[model samples]
Target: MYAVFKRELFSLLNSLMAYITIGVFLLALGLLLWFFPDTSILDYGYAELTGFFSLAPFLFMFLIPAITMRSFAEERREGTYILLATRPLTDWQIILAKYLACLVLVLFSLIPTLIYYYSISELGLPKGNIDTGAVIGSYIGLLLLGSAFTAVGVFASSVTKNQVIAFAISVFICFIVYTGFDAMSQIFALQYLESLLIGLSVNEHYQSISRGVLDTRDLVYFISFVALFLGLTRFVIGGRKW
Candidate 1:
C-alpha cells in the first residue's frame, strides 16, 4: 500500500502536467480574488478571506476532477489496470493509495493560499483584526471538503477508462453531492424530508464548520462521505477484476 502510494504520488509530481494543474488552480483563484476590480478583495472592503472560502468550493468542483480524472482512468485506458490488479495489493489498498495521492496534491494546491490569510490579517484596519477562529475553521472545512471531492473524483475515474468522461462524471457528482440536496430540500414539501435533505448536503456541513465551530457531526459527515466514495472505488475495481 505504501509503495503504491509513493509510486502514485511520485508519478504525479514527476509530471509537468501536475505542476500545470496546480498553477492553473492558483492562478484562477488568485485572479478572481485579487485582480478583478469588481470582485477583488480590496474592493470588498473587508479584511477577511470570505471570498476565498466562498469561491474555492465552486472552483474545486472543476480543479479537483481535472487532477484525478487521469488517476485510474488512464491506467484502465492504457491496460495498466490489469497490471495493477495482478499486483500483491488489495483493491482497497490500491484505491486508498490513489485517493491519498490525489488528496496530497489537493493540499499542495491549498498550502500556497495561506499567504492570502496573512495578507488579509495584515491588511485589517486595526491590524490582525481578522477572525482567526473562523479562518482556521474554514481551512479545516476546506481540507475536509477537498478530501471528499478527491475521493469522489477517484471513484469517478475508477468507473471509466476515458479521462474526459471521468472528469465530467466527477464534476457532476461533486456538484450534486455538494449542493443538490440543498436544492431538493427547497423543493420538497415535507418538513422532515426537507430537513433530512439539507442535513445530507455537503454545503450545509461545510458552512457549519466554516463558521468556526468544530462540531463532531460535521467531522463525521465528511469522514463518512470520503469513506463511502473510496469504498465505492474499491467495489468498482473489484467488480472489474471479476
Candidate 2:
C-alpha cells in the first residue's frame, strides 16, 4: 500500500496534470477573490471569505475529476491492471493508497490558499476581525467535500479503461451527488421527504459547516459518503478480477 501510494504520488507530480490542476485552482481563486472587481470579496466587504468558500466546491467538481480521472483508468488502459492485480496487495489496499494519494494532492493545492487568509487578516479593519472559527470550519468542510469527490472519481475511474469516459462519469456523478438532492428537495410532495432530500445534499452540510457550526451528523455524512464510494470502487475492481 505504501509503495502504491508513493508511486501514484510520484507519477502525478511528474506529469503535466499536477501542474495544470494546481494552476487552474490558483487561477480560479485569483479570479474569484482578487481580480473580479465588483464581486471581489476583498474589494467589497469585510475580510470574509464567503465568496472563496462558496466557489470552491463548485470549482472542485471539475478540478477533482481532472486529478483523479486517470488513477485506475489509465492503469487499465495501459494493460497494467493485470500486473497490479497479480501483486500481493488486496483491492482495498490499492484503492486506499490511490485515494490517499489523491487526497494529498487536493490538500496540497488547498494549503497555498491560506496565504489569502493571512492577507485578509492583515488587511482587516481591526487587524483580524475575521471569523477565525468560520474560516477553520470552512476549510474542514472543504477537505471532507474534496475527499468525497475524490472517492467518486476513483470509483468512476475503476469502472472504465478510458480516461475520458472516467472523467466524464466522475464529473456527472459529482454533480448529481453534490446538487441533485437539493433539486429533488424542491419537487418532493411530502414535507418529510423534502427535508430528507435537503439533508442528504452535500451543499446543505457544507453550508452548515462553513458557517462555523460543526455538527457531528454532517461530519458523519461526509465520512460515510466517502466510504460508500470507496467501498464501491473496491467491489468493482475485485469483481472485475472474478
Candidate 3:
C-alpha cells in the first residue's frame, strides 16, 4: 500500500495534470477572493472567507475529477492495470492508496490559501476581526467535501478504461451528490421527504459546518459519504477481476 501510494503521488507530481489543476484552483481562488469585487471583498466590510469557501465546492467539482480521472482509467487504457492487479495488494489497498494520493494533492493546493487568512487579518479594521472559528470550520468542511468528491471520482474512474469518460462521469456524479438532493427537495410533495432530501445533500452538511457549527451529524454524513463511495470503488475493481 505504501509503495503504491508513493508511486501514485510521484506520478501525479511528475505530470502536467497536477500543476494544471493546482494552477486553476489558485487562479479561481484569487479571482473570487481578491480580484472580483463583491460583498465579500476585503474593502467591502466582509472579513470572513464566506465567499471563498462558498466557491470551493464548485471549483472542486472540476478539480477533483481532473485529479482522479487518470487514477485507474489511464492504467487500464495502457494495459498496466493487469500488472497492478497481479500484485500482492488487495483492491481496497489500491483504492485507498490512490485516494490518499489525491487527497494529499488537494490539501497541498489548499495550504497556500492560508495566506489569504493573514492578508485579510492585516487588512481588517480591528487587525483581525474575522471569524476565526468559522474559517477553520469551513476549511475542515472543504477538506471533507473534497475527499468525498475524490472518492466518487475514483469510483467513476474504476468503472471505465477511458479517462475522458471517467472525468465526465466523475464530474456528473459529484455534481449530483453535491447539489442534486437540494434540487430534489424542491420537487418533493411531502415535507418530510423534502427535509430528508435536503439533509442528504453534501451542500447542506457543508453549509452547516461552514457556519462554524461543527455538528457531529454533519461530520458523520461526510465520513459516511466518502466511505460509501470508496467501498463501492473497491467492490467494482474487485469484481472486475472475478
Q: Which candidate number has the best lDDT?
A: 1
Candidate 3 versus the native: TM-score?
Answer: 0.96
In candidate 3, where is summed lDDT lowest over 10 consecutive residues? 37-46
Task: List, in order, the clash count of every candidate structure.
Answer: 0, 0, 0
Residue-wise C-alpha lDDT for candidate 1, range 1-242, written one tens digit per residue:
99989999999889788799889889999999999987799999998988999999999999899889999999988998898889888888888899999899999999999999999988998999899999999999999999999999999999999999999999999999998998888774655589789899999999999999999999999999999999898888888899
**Taking the tens digit of each residue's C-alpha lDDT, what string does model 3 give over 18-123?**
8988898899879887877763476567677788888889999999999999999999889998998899988888999999999999999899999989988888
Whole-model alpha-carbon lDDT for candidate 1: 0.92
What is the TM-score (0 to 1) of candidate 2? 0.96
- Candidate 2: 10-residue stretch with minimal lDDT: 183-192
Report clash pairs, candidate 1: none
lDDT by residue (1-242, candidate 2, tens digit) is: 99999999988889897788889988988888898886698677788888899889988999999999999999999999799889999989999999999999999999999988998999998898789999999999999899999999999999999888998999999998889988887874655588888888888998988888899999999999999999999889888899
Per-model TM against the reference: 0.96, 0.96, 0.96
lDDT of residue 166 for candidate 1: 97
Off by over 4 Å in 2: 188-192
